[model samples]
Target: MKKVAPPQCLQNAFEENGLTQIDVFEFPEGTHTAVDAAKAIGCNVSDIGKSLVFVTETLNPILIVMNGADQVDMNKAANLLGLPIRKAEATEVRETTGYVIGGVPPFGHAKPVETLIDKKLLEKDTVWLAAGTPKTVFSLSTRDLRDVTGIETGVDVSA
Candidate 1:
């Protein structure tokens, strides 16, 4: 088996902030999808945090942290964000977030981005989330996650 390390920029993000070094676990089986992540981590799907990138009509990127078991209701999300949004293209995801689709973390980004966490995830004490790669993950407290993203409240954007 080969070892896969997360991007240096990602590691630096935690280090530079003086936060605990997030223990990233690698799964040869892959943790790209939320269901797959939950299976690999031995947790319920709802306990998995899925970070998604949505592009607003204005071409701005918003990172939405969602529960694995729920899907974003586009209409509700748009109403909450005050703009129409669509899933970002793969290229757009990488360019705006410095990450590929299956591994977009809730907070670290190439640039500062507005972020929102779903109320469902906020209800969990801890959840496993992708660690900047499709095959890696880490566990963090929901409170810490909220603090890191600077989103004090969660939104009801799930369908």
Candidate 2:
């Protein structure tokens, strides 16, 4: 079997952001879900940074980078952002981020979207995130993630 390459968008973003330490890994089986990624990488599920997209009441896009072990509390998240929020549909997610649901990274989006980092993810030294493809992922430290993504302080938006 032939190996698959990482998505160009993800590659360009990593390079432009100076994420020299980020290393993309590909799994033959696939890592579309947190459980799948954790199993493939031999890490705790919480160490997987799940990038989720949501739509604010006003129809703006918001990106939430949460720990795989956690679940987003829409009400609490809405309160934090001061706007009612709902999960983005498949089409909406692809259109807004230019990536599919299982492949969206924390950054490197086609356009800028409001971003929030889950505090739980900050507790880990390293976390894995989708690399613009379900079969691929990359690792980065918590601090480096914040620096590269330009995300400020983490928040308690997960339950």
Candidate 3:
């Protein structure tokens, strides 16, 4: 069997952060949603930490990690961050994060940007997140996750 090449940025982040990388699974196109990703990984949807990329009116990029079953409350997020928030279009997401909409990881951006993590995601010991590609995901402990990624916890980004 042929092996798939891992996303370079994910590998780079693992190296930079001294993290023990988990396994990644690749699916065919159009499996970017949490439900579809869970199906591909043979896990529950809530186990997937949906990485949402948003842009402020200033054009600054930010990442939000939420439970797959939850939706981000933009108004609440804006109030928390004290900035006007807007859903980043596909073009802007790629331009700022160097990753497409469904594949934006919680960490390892081209540079550091503010990050907000939903409190609900803490329920699990480990959560799966995108690895710079729609078809790829990796599992990391929720506690140790911040060691490799700069995530601000206790934010209610979920609705």
Candidate 1, pairs of clashing residues? none
Residues 70-131, candidate 2, lDDT per residue (tens digit)? 89999899999999999999999998888998888898888888899998898889899988
How far residue 68's Cα lies from its native spot in candidate 2, in Å, is 0.6
Candidate 3 on 26-77: residue-level lDDT in tens?
6775348899788887888999999888888888888888899899999999
Off by over 4 Å in 1: 1-4
Root-mean-square deviation (CA) per prediction: 1.6, 1.7, 2.0
Question: Relative to the true structure, how large is the alpha-carbon lDDT of every model?
Answer: 0.86, 0.87, 0.79
Prediction 2 global C-alpha lDDT: 0.87
Predicted model with the maximum lDDT:
2
Residue pairs with backbone atoms closer than 3 Å in model 3 (clashes): none
Worst 10 residues of 1 by lDDT: 1-10
For model 3, what is the error of residue 9's alpha carbon versus the real structure, in angstroms, after optimal superposition? Answer: 1.7
Clashes of 1: 0
Distance (Å) between predicted and true CA of 151, model 1? Answer: 1.2
